[model samples]
Target chain A: MIHTEQLTKVYPGTDFAAVDCLDLEVGTGEIFGLLGPNGAGKTTTAGMLTTRVIPTSGRALVGGVDVAAQPALAKQVSGIVSQQNTLDRQLNVWENLYFHGRLFGMGATTSRRIADELLEQFQLEKWAQASVYALSGGMAQRLMVARAIFHRPAVLFLDEPTAGLDPQSRLALWEVLGQLNRDGQTIMLTTHYMEEADRLCHRVAIMDHGKILALDTPAALKRGIGADTIVTVRAAADPEQLAAVLARDVAGVERARVADGAVQLDVSGGQRLVQQIVLAAERAGADILDLSITEPTLETVFITLTGRELRD
Target chain B: MAASDVTGDVTTRAVPARIELQLRPVLTASYSALGALLLRDLVVLWKDKWVFVLRTVIQPFLLCFVFLYVFPKIGQGVGGGGGRRGESSFATVLVPGVVGISIMFQGVQSIALNMAQEFGFTREIEDRVQAPCPIWLVAMAKVLSGAAQGALSAVLVLPIAAVVHAAGVHAHLDLRWWIILTLVPLACIAMAGLGLVLGTSFEPRNIGLMFGFIILPITFLGGTYYGWTTLSPVRIGGFHWLQVLVLINPLMYVNEGMRAAFTSSPHMHLYVIYPVMAAFATTFLAIGLRNFRRRVLA
Candidate 1:
């Protein structure tokens, strides 16, 4: 389990805090996700909890050891898979896991046996003797995960776990993480991939600018958008004004705002919705260039909350 | 501990029982992790033992062959001395110097050069530091392994001194047991510490600058071809600036100590050599460990 109380980090020479007054808790058996775009302080949050980056203020406890105060002990309890392929380049595939086991105080025979088992479980036994350079990107990532968990850490922390992988590899990593969680690993990961969060995390916290705007199960978060459908209208100009006018005047429209150069509306139900939309746009002296309707998703929820796309 | 026993504990320990951390438990863990880290490096070295031996011996071997064997036999030619007597004397200086420089090269090449890549953009040192010990201990592992390699290179290079001269161009080694036992290990530690400082001080991109500016200067002026005692003539205003300047070079102490250990050649007194070498070793390790901590954190 991981818990933090107003954990904060303001990198030196910067006036702004990267992670600000964050109070977070991750339960022992849940897969938690911090969903945000780059610089959202998601990685910084993960860094603080993992004790890689010391927090400027506040406290973080991982597996009941204060990470900032007792990093050595915290490290014993936590496993980390960073975004990069951090597999040791010098070691063969098997030695990578074997040494990790050794670093965690496992006996030589225990380390070797567990390493061999991990290689088999991760489907990397064929390359056990091969240098890490021989692995493809996905295989290398899997090997890193296998090494991280070789110590049977209490909590597993992954930072942007699948930022750069082929679709197959990404899915494969997801499956691997899912299996680990099922085996009772306390999992926490930070990612910008909405689908990854939705599919993999039991609880997802939508984060932006170092603050969580919302947190809930993905299903509950999506349902919290308070509408069944999303209608996006791109106009020639003045989309914000058009959105305000539409929100105030249109029936069944729960919320409307300008997002990604368009007026997006969350509508619960609608008859003659397109006709009403066009009439409202014209009345607001806006020319509609494009109009689209999508079923509400976590993305729609995000844009509704932040008034900007996740990538932006 | 059986694999079967651990297999079941894996499920129960997942939540980690509230992490009641006491220093004794963690200290025990740190010792095992440190031992394991060194073991990993030893295993890597053993895997490449052939290449390692070849790399370690090649430079000193050639230095001795060309200067001690070929030049002495080819008469007073390039690197040959004034005559048999001069070449023979130069052989004494060259042989121990070759051993000293070999120790320096092995330390730098093993720890610093490899560290350039480990801390490079790939940051291959990531998982290593994440071991269940203090970050400084991780660096200590590097220094220890590098020192061992330096000692190994010394051991490997010493045989060349005994065997490699032309018949008359003798090194005149005294084999002082007391000095050899104490000084050789001290020299290894000093050179390995210097390697640590260089490797951590330079970024991967500017490693060429380290070689051009730091390593080259350390090698040439490190008293390999001559003795520190012979540098009295290169003085202006009785300053002995070059001699004083090379004093700042840790390799000077190492080469001088090698002479004290191996030959009757004039060396900087062992009195100055021991404390100064220890100071250099401690200073380099302190700076290098600080730099390493800075690089690893924040």
Candidate 2:
């Protein structure tokens, strides 16, 4: 649904492109994530696609319409939730959404109907008449998203949709996004939240310094590290002894170490290996205080690929 | 993710039908979008009606009250200070100037000050530019809305300016219907266009300088205190340099236009007022829209 061909934007008087020669594609109905650290040009890429920032060079197409050549047409099929809150503070929640619909040439009645549905969907019905300045951060963010999609754009670009939110509000937004994607809306979200990308995006592009470093499904990206699972064991009696026992007895235990009163193991097929490690700990007379078998996360993939932390 | 066919059918059936039924016939989609943008500003202004009225009326009221009423009552040097005739002529000149300045201030307050805030760190303009119209149209909406506010300020200021005076210093308002109907709106729009130019040019941090260097000078030289004809006396070897110089100030024409519309004072000729105001409006709008687009993209 969204395509770019070496889409580059070098701001005036700058030596480097904000977005380099970047070729990317997002298929219809996919929830794609652009994962990166700050100053990684994620927002710039989204801005180009949304027609808010003109590309210094190259081209972007939204729903097959060239953005620079026919910006109004591209705008018709694209809605952007900028990293900053851009909701009209002078307007109330309902007015914000309704006006967005009207701007897209929707009839007043249709706008009202759609705005009502959006308010209900985002659970903003109670605050529909409330001024934007009166809303909490979470409500304001939700209202921004509602205004974006009020016109039912074909693709929705959410730039850091969950930044600075409490855990509960972030999770609430994730559910809303999931439902929108399920409704067959193509979504491209840029975020530094590793867990958010892992949980929500069907595919993610790890970007840094105006370039894509890695792109794949979260599971596949994590598996690319060649470690299927991580087994961390907190042993009450002796972590060193538990680590020794697991290394010797647990099959597929590739490596083991003890730190912070815990024995961590890199193992293949940890579901099965964890059971053996647990049994071995019991036989070794070391109490297993806590144990977990976790697949490597997107953070692991990001660090391995970029040699820098997601937030760095 | 696949949407159900039932949902798809409903969307297809309802969206276009509602568009046809509710949107005004013969209105292009662009016009409706522009109208909606202007309407949003009006709604916001309406919500803050008391604040708006206070801001609009206080300055004009004070100008009229001080110069027309208080100055004469206190035996101050104003209104030529000769007799009833002198006081009345000064009232005629000051009334239009007060109305003119009010319109100018309205344009600046409604558009420029608001633009500064929107373009600041808040970035509210991003949401506005996202409206599915050309970027220029977005700036045009600001001008149109600002013009409407300017026109309203003229209406609010005029009666207060006309009546709030010392007993001897009464404005002789001609109430020329043709000039009032035509000139006032054009003058409002012209000042609004000027507001757009200034708003987009100055940084928010330097807005104080806009008033210090630009607004103060424009008001003082904009024929608010005296008619353009009065400038002929303040000359360099009969050059009428002050009169010639004030012509470049857009508000001078607006004030002249106001005088033509509101009083029978021997102001600048109508031949100059109408065409010159038109040219100023066009020039300000052209420059303002260009600057607006640049600032928005920047």
Candidate 3:
């Protein structure tokens, strides 16, 4: 549904390109996540794809139309929910959606009908007659989504759809996105939250410094590290002694490091490794106060590849 | 036989559906989209109907009453044409001037001030620009709405202004029907174009500076209290430099056009008024469009 080849955008008076040579494709009816830290060019890429910002070089196509050559066509196929809330604060919730539909050439009656349905679907029917200024942050974000999809565009581009929302609100928004994808709308979203990407996206791309570091499904990206579990053991004595013993005893230990008075190891079979590592620690006259075996998460994958935490 | 008949019906229905989709009438759809944007703005104004109406009528009404009626009643004369034979009374002379200034200020306040806020912290303009039309059309909608408001202000202010104080002011209002019909819209358009340029040029942070540096000067020197021709005697030895200075002000033509339409006062010649106003409109529109495009892209 969307494709880009070496897409780049460099703002005037800036040295480095905001979006540098990004090669991406989002298939029809799939939720693709562009995961990156703040200022990592995800929003710039989405802006160029939506034709809100002209690309400095490269090509993009949305629904078989070249975006640079035929921006209106691309706009017709894609709806954008920018990072900033673009809801009309002066207008009521229903009026905002109705005006969006009208901009896409729907008649007044049809626009109101579609707006009403979307409002109901987003659970915003109670706020239909309420001005946007009266809405809470989560309600306003949901209204922004409703306004974007009121035209029924084939592809939806959401730039940080869940930023600043509480956990419940983020999960509710993810459910809405999942339902939209199941109903055959292609979705492209950018997010800094690792769990959002893991739970929502069918395919995820990790980007930093205007570059895509990696791309794959959440499970596949995690599995690419080859370690299924992380074993962390708290030590009463020096952690270096326990780390040395674990390094000598555990065969499947891929990496061992001491942090916060705990010997943490990435291993293949965490259950067996935990049993053996605890025995080794007790024999070394070190008390194993606590032990935890965790499944490898996106955070570990990101740290292994980039050598930094996603938030950092 | 029954299955074949159902399949034939479905195929026949699909063929026309494909044809209808193919012939979907592109230009009309685009025009309708533009119209929808225009109507959307108008509807928003309508929803705030009382506020808009009060905003349009109140300021001009107060200015006309205080400056034309109450001030002269308290023995403050506005013009030097009080005792001349063919000259108009102060109220007569000030009527069109008040109307013209009101329209100009209305355009600036409604269009420029509102644009500053939209392009400020709220960034409501972004949603408007996201409409399916070209970016230029979005800017045009702003100008059009401002012009509509200006026109409405002109209509609402004239009658209240005309009948406010009638005792010794024998002001003959020769409302040239043709001039009123043609020039009011032109004046509104010109003022709206100027407003557009001002709106895009001033960032919200420095809007107070814009009024101090630009709007105040334009209002005072815009031939609001006196005719442009009347300023001829205050020139340098052989040059009408004051009149020439006011030429750069778009409100000069609006006031001149009002003079020609409302009273028998000697005013700036029609030939100069028409072309100068047209030139100002074109220049402001070009600059406004360029600035709007640059800002939106940025």
Candidate 4:
């Protein structure tokens, strides 16, 4: 549904490219996530494909149309939900969808019918006549998604779709996106939320410094670390020093490093690993302030690849 | 593992992607999209029609009320200073002048002010420009809608301006239908095109600079308070610098066109007004569309 070949974008007066030689393909019927922190080139990549950002060099195609060369055609095939609230405040909720239909060439009767259906489908029927201002954030987001798909775009691109939502709203959006995908809509989303990438995306590309460091499914990525347990520690001493000590002392410790002001280690041991980590901290004279063990996540995969946290 | 880990993940969902719609050619699609964009603007205007009427009438009404009615009643008539005849003649000139100013102000308020909020306030333009059309066409829609509002303001303000005078002081209005029908639309489009330029040129927060530098100067010097022929006396040694300088203002052509349409007042010759007004409209719309494309794209 989407393809990019060495797509690069170097903004004027910048020392480096915002997106550097990104070669990517998003197939039909897939929930693909570009997982990265701020300044990681995710949004820039999406912008290039959407024709909002002109690439410095290389080509991006959406459903066989070159985005830069034929942006209007690209727009016909791809629907976008920007990171900001972009609903028209002047129009009521129904008019927002109605006008969207009109702009896409639907007749007035057809526009009204579709607008009613979308309002009902997105559970916004109660607020159909109300001003958009009256909606809560979650409801507004649902309306945005409904408007996006009203034209039945081939691929839907969402940039940080759930960045500032409350937990319930975020979960609701995840479900909404998941439902759309199941109904045969190709979806691509960019997010810094590791859990969102892990739970929602079928495949995720971890990016930093404008390059993809790793790309795989969440399970495969977690298993690729080759660790059964992940132990995070906060110590009184320097975290890097404590990480060094634990990496050497722990028996099944495959690797260790400091991320987000804490020491983290990937180990292969069983249930006794926590006790062994405690013993190692005591022996190294490290006053461990906090310690926890959990299974590896997409975040651990990112840390293993880049030596940094996903939220950094 | 922690308690949160136990409730860790949700089931993932995926399905095949399918899209089936017979899209028309690019130009056809853009044409309807452009019409729809204008319709959206019209619907918004309709919803606030009462406020629109009030906004269109208030300024022109007050100008007529103060200049034609109150000033003549208080014996402080402008340009005449005394008799009912002189005051009545001033009213005739002022009537069309107020209509011209109304068209100009309506265009600016509708296009430029709304653009400031859309571009800067909430990024509301994000969804607007995403419509299935070329970016410049989106801008043309705004110009078209603003022009519609300007024309409507002209219709609303003319009668109000012509009749609001003191008793026994009546202004003669010789309605040249040819000029009125052609020149009013031309004046509207030209001014709305200027609205597009000013709208795209000014940033949202610094919009005060738009009025301070562009609007106020256009209003005071664009021959709205007097006819263009009257500016011939304010010259230096046969230079006619003031007359030539006001020619640079697009509103001068609009007001001059209005004078030719509404009253038998002396104005810039018909030969100079139409083509120059058309040229101004074309030039402003071109620059405005360019600025709009630049703003929306990057």
Q: Which has the higher DockQ value, candidate number 1 or candidate number 4?
A: 4
Pick by DockQ: 1 or 3, better one: 1
lDDT for each residue of candidate 1 in A41-99, tens digit (9 for 90 to 100)? 99999988887899999999888889999888888988899888778777899999988
Report the lDDT tens digits of candidate 2 across residue range A1-312. 788999999999999888899999998778999998989999989888888788988988887778888776667777888878888888889999998888878788999999999899888999999988888888888899888877677788999998888889898899989978777778999999899999999999999889998899998888777778778898777777777788899888766766556776767765567568778988998878788878778876776676555767
Candidate 2 lDDT at A83 equals: 73
Give residue B113's error in model 4 in angstroms.
0.9
**lDDT (CA) for every model shown?**
0.87, 0.84, 0.80, 0.87
| Poorest lDDT segment (10 consecutive residues) of candidate 4 chain B | B8-17
- The better candidate by TM-score, 1 or 2, is 1
Q: What's the residue-level lDDT of A24 in candidate 1?
A: 91
- C-alpha TM-score for every candidate: 0.93, 0.85, 0.89, 0.95
The most accurate candidate by DockQ is 4
Please give the lDDT score for candidate 2.
Answer: 0.84
Candidate 1, what DockQ?
Answer: 0.45
Evaluation by TM-score, superior candidate among 2 and 4: 4
lDDT of 3 at B230: 77
User: What is the Å distance of residue A157 in model 1 from its true position?
Assistant: 0.7
> Candidate 1 lDDT (Cα, whole model)?
0.87
Q: Which candidate number would show the highest TM-score if scored against the true structure?
A: 4
